[model samples]
Target: MRSDYKELDNEKIYLVTGAAGFIGFHLSKRLLDEGCHVIGIDNLNDYYDVNLKKARLEIINKYDKFKFFKIDLQDKEFLEEIFKEHKIDIVVNLAAQAGVRYSITNPDVYIQSNIVGFLNILEVCRHYKVEHLVYASSSSVYGMNEVMPFSVHHNVDHPISLYAATKKSNELMAHTYSHLYNLPTTGLRFFTVYGPWGRPDMALFLFTDAIMNDKPIKVFNHGKMKRDFTYIDDIVEGIVRLLNNPPKENKEWDKIKADPGTSSAPYKIYNIGNNKPVELMEYIQTIEKHLGKEAKKEYLPLQDGDVPMTYADVDDLIDDVGFKPDTSINEGISKFVEWYKEYYEV
Candidate 1:
């Protein structure tokens, strides 16, 4: 909601890592639009397309209140310099080596970026005394758990991919900082975030691109996979609602029967998702309908580090933020296709 951003103190400086990224760019723009000064950081890595990342930055650069820096998160020196340069009231750490399948081949990058980079973020947030730190965690951390609707309270110790492991590690590291340094932190477990300016590596983007060009789209798990495909705007709204409300010490937290999502310390985790899962075929059909094209599907077995379904239990998110993602796939896909057509002139 715009009201949430309007109520925020415009004097507060927000540091957003991965400002060139899909989520980071959108979040940075939203903050800037609300008159909040923002410092953006990104390594500008060629994880996918460097051009696309730069294009996102081009839009963010237009804002007078927004400042951009091209720096890797593992470079703690530069990161700390940024902390010293600005009295950052809030930090949203969205920079990470994304992609589950890519992690299977490139485990080293995951460790370096996701693990070490995140540690640097935690260290800076602890020392700088940032009022709140919000970072991205993924529903991929629900690895191997056959749970229908994954809950934050569920134990996510069985991550199958290095990518998922790194995200889970982020949540744990943030909790440790919250406990040791009294740092306020919140980890959002996002589910299938997609929309215009979205990452090209995601299924929705890949499917759309292939269908538009009349290429055969890879249909994994014989098109039986399901996902809680959340729209980018909804995800941003949920994050905005939580930015000002950092977690307080849960005095009622049961140590005997520990809850993985919350602690006696100032740390909490919530799943920001649509709470409704859609079949892979249905998602593809929606894309096709918007594109006015049919995809040549090639059926395949479930790939490595891939799950058949992901449905989020967003009760905590709804209860805490009084918000729920209600954007239908049809509406979201239609907007994405329109943007795609205009951007690519297809």
Candidate 2:
């Protein structure tokens, strides 16, 4: 036997939706780094900043292992064409209409993208017999819950916003597919993810921009809001670790005493977060301290579709994958500031 039997190339043929977005961009880059063939698809939507999305794609396309697809998942015909072309060993569904407050004004877009679009992906995956399906779920699903650290095991039946409801619906819909088809699905319930290449709409990015430009950044809930501010690198690490480890049949799973985290079929849900909540104001101060600039402030009541605080229980993440988001907000925010100054030529 050859001694080189180990470290055989996995050679996974992967499809990544929303490959131009923040998390999608990071994940795709990591997969490309691992010598995996990655097919990246995105509509290049003008939600926040189109240039930023394009910039992310530029980095990904530099790798000979990456292929780019500029298409929307909502286009059933186009999406189906892609499925037929690629073997698609695995899929990471990251495409969706994001933002809580925006959902109130453009509810139809949320339905079209998050719900109808998700169905298209699920149907295609079922048809292709894809190996593993990983999709993004949101911490917003913890809406109106009195619990301190939101657990995947808790009942997520109550969602305050249309956005949160749609994400929660994805989990339920994914579970149904896993049950009926043995599809082996994993849903990542992401908390407040922040760091370099973050979305312009996210608080940290917006605050950094506003502070640099001497513009006022809105402080929601009078700055009383707290978040489980996970760093981007940590989130990416957790995802990559779970990519090769799809959920298997939970033999110990009890039907009589059902657990929301697992099912009789090959389906699982886990929270990916820092497991530590940070005060919103304190987070801002970290940014300010890094940038050497104070932000013009606008204190406001909590907006619709938003919660006062969100903390994630990541015990399962650590116990199962030996994973924990260990990046500190200070280090994370400082890195962001450094990137911002260089990107903007400030």
My TM-score estimates for the predictions, one after another, are: 0.97, 0.96
lDDT of each: 0.92, 0.90
Instruction: Point out the worst 10-residue segment of candidate 1 by lDDT.
Output: 1-10
Winner by TM-score? 1
Q: In model 2, what lDDT does residue 81 have?
A: 94
In model 2, what are the clashing residue pairs, if there are any? none
lDDT (tens digit, per residue) of candidate 2 on 201-248 = 999989988887789999999999999999999998888877777788
Instruction: In angstroms, give how far residue 135 of model 2 lies from its true place.
Output: 0.4
Query: Model 2: runs farther than 4 Å from truth?
Result: 1-9
Model 1, 270-307: lDDT tens digits are 99999999999999999988888899999999999998
- Give the CA lDDT, 0 to 100, for residue 149 in model 1: 93
lDDT, residue 213, candidate 1: 85
